[model samples]
Target: MDKTTTAAPSAAALAAGRRAGWLRELRETFTLAWPLVIAQVAQNALITTDVIMMGWLGPKQLAAGTLASTFIMPFLVGAVGLISAIAPLVAQARGARNIRAVRRIVRQGFWATIILSALLIPLILQVKPIFLFLGQNPETTMLAEQYIQIGVAMFIPGLAVVVLRSMLSAFNTTRIILVLTLAAVVVNAIGDYLLMFGVFGLPRLELRGAAIATVVTNLFMFVVFLAYVLNHKRFRRFHILWNFWKPDWHHLAQIFRIGTPIGMTVLAEVGLFTAAALLMGLIGTNEIAAHAIAMQSASMAFMVPLGLGVACTVRVGYAYGRGDDEGVRKAGWTALGLSTAFMTVSCITFILGAPLIVTIFLDPDRAANTDALRLGASYLVVAGLFQLVDGAQVVAAHALRGLSDTKVPMLVAIVSYWFIGLPIAYVMGFTFNLQGVGIWLGLAAGLAFAAIVLVIRFAMRERLGLLRRTL
Candidate 1:
């Protein structure tokens, strides 16, 4: 054979192999992200399911459901952050081929979650009355109390499920979370249909029924998650605390050592949105209602970026474990680029279809809506600008966490949400009289600042061997 002619086949083969590898990576990323994405969507659907079921019992039930849900957010998100300490830890352990450490991490997470859940129930119970005193109507206050009692009463089962789900995600078994989420959604929806409306021999319980459905579904899922995690190859070695697994003060210290700042990080950022929603309530139910509509739309766009953020943490943690500087850089860039591209398209769609999006939450007679149609449209329009920055900030924060440099980004959030975001929203909305859109615009500024600083910090950490130093 002629030398050049013979070499041509090898070149072609190499190119084909490269293409295949790229395709495989893309596939793996999609597969891993798909479960998380669906889980998030269904989780949102579960909330919407409550709202939809309550819509039948008149405005009071709907209003009560939304109001009570706000008090539940701190525990949910903060606990998720605390559980998230397992992901990077598991990823690094997986990369190092240390299955035992990963198992220990997950089991410890579950045991610790139980203690935290116990602590949280009373905090919410005591403060429930305080929220009621924050100038609510008589009817709304009564409904809010009922919803809170049912929901918080069910917090333990719900809390166990999330912590276990996080453990599954840590070992790259997101499929279990997706399955559980789907099961939970379907069961909850049916329970809402039956119990809320008194179908299928169930009594007409309405909002309380929705809460009970959630609790029952969560309980069912906790069992399923337990079964799957035990069967998982990565987790099979560790016993599931058949004996006493009391709170290891030292391990709890370690968890909170890593987890507390991250928990505060979640609390600060989500707290901003929750507080903004409450402030919107001050302006009018119209404003609060419109804000909810816009938020649902934004959350859809958020899923892609959110999935990217998860992937970033996994890749960053793995690269950091291997001590591969170049791999770490490539992983971060790839995650950011992919996330930004997908999210930018989603944002554009949201901007263009804001009204159509809002209409889902309304009817022609508009029974579910209390606001003008134009309000949600206006909110989504301004909200579009923030998607890019929001995507940037979240992905950056995830990457930083992957590198185990979580504190700086947490600090960035503190400044962005409190110092810059909330103050600006208050000034722009009430002070300047712009209201809902003004508040979102204020949030956009916070996201922009968070995005810029986190990206800068990521670069600094990568160059300075911050991951190496931390590990």
Candidate 2:
């Protein structure tokens, strides 16, 4: 029982305790992340069903729908980013056990959604003129406009669903979100079949029918989720909707204050891809086709990290709200590690299965698709190279969001994607003649830069004074 022997046992016990704590955090992160991941996949399935059904109408209809979707997505994603602020806010409130604050935050989230929809719906409705100004074909623009007219109606409901989903996510009740989203996918598919093709004695509505189906699906999700939130024992205690009409300008403005930069950050990343597609178009038709196939594969792989990022925001926010600095560190690092591990597997898949993935999108036996297939396989290789950094950047950004740090991340994204990545892309793709490969390389460069910067920022949180405001 000398001093050295006693110290050894003490140190060993401390180490064991730390390991147990980390194991618990890992379990909690996984439990929260899986359902969110499945819900994300289900949401993607809803969009995929629309694309498949549009293809049934003919190439022209498919093209129009693609154009409309391209036009609408930036707005939709940006608005969702704004609404996403609700998650961290509600999570923090829950951790603080401030039920009144939770209700006020959610009420303001709904308000922000309404305000954003009002401002955005009109702008989206002007897609016809905007596309025309962008020099799109008049016929295709008209067709896209037709779909958008009805499709824009879903905007409000869609944002409302985000508000409700955010609240649920903060409570660690994401399973219902998954169930609802999967059900919506089924509903949307059936609606598309019956309306788009005039099945079951229905009149053929073509592109409009698809749009109508999307609107109905979104509305149904919003209404049903609202009902559940209102009536559920765990949720109704907060009385989130009891004073739905009363304005909480303070929280509303806080949402915008924290969320606008987030919205801009999303737009910046999206704009980079949109610009990359335009660059691919400048190269050749085969390149454009290849880019589309490769991008779709990357996007599908990205959903996992995106969902994990959402969970990170909540977990980290909870720790921040509780004023548990060690908890915050554990939550953030656990999520980053989880995301990195998953993306590592995804990267290996992309590297090893590029050709197989390309074949899934384009037939190898078709002469017309041969070039596109080769190019798509090459692009997937580049996608593999960027996978780790992409996952890192997203999770890091969300981790910072949990600490209410967004403005700096937004600036980092803009500078990385536009100034650093885009310039390299232009020089390599056009000036150096690397073409599609060069563009993909540029994307990797951008994501890597963002990942490095954001991760460093998170690591330096204490020195940067990011934890000072934590309750």
Model 2 steric clash pairs:
none
lDDT of 2 by residue, 14-90 (tens): 99999999999999999999999889888887777776666555445655776777678889989999889999988
- RMSD after CA superposition, every candidate: 3.5, 2.2
Q: Give the CA lDDT, 0 to 100, for residue 57 in model 1.
A: 60
Candidate 1's TM-score: 0.90
User: lDDT tens digits, residues 332-429, model 1?
Assistant: 76677777887788788888888787666655365446464578789988888888888888888888887777777789999999999999999999
Estimate candidate 2's alpha-carbon lDDT, on a 0 to 1 scale: 0.88
| Candidate 1 ranges beyond 4 A from true positions | 1-28, 55-59, 242-250, 367-372, 469-471
TM-score of each: 0.90, 0.94
Indicate the residue-level lDDT of 411 in model 2.
Answer: 99
* lDDT for each candidate structure: 0.75, 0.88
lDDT of 1: 0.75
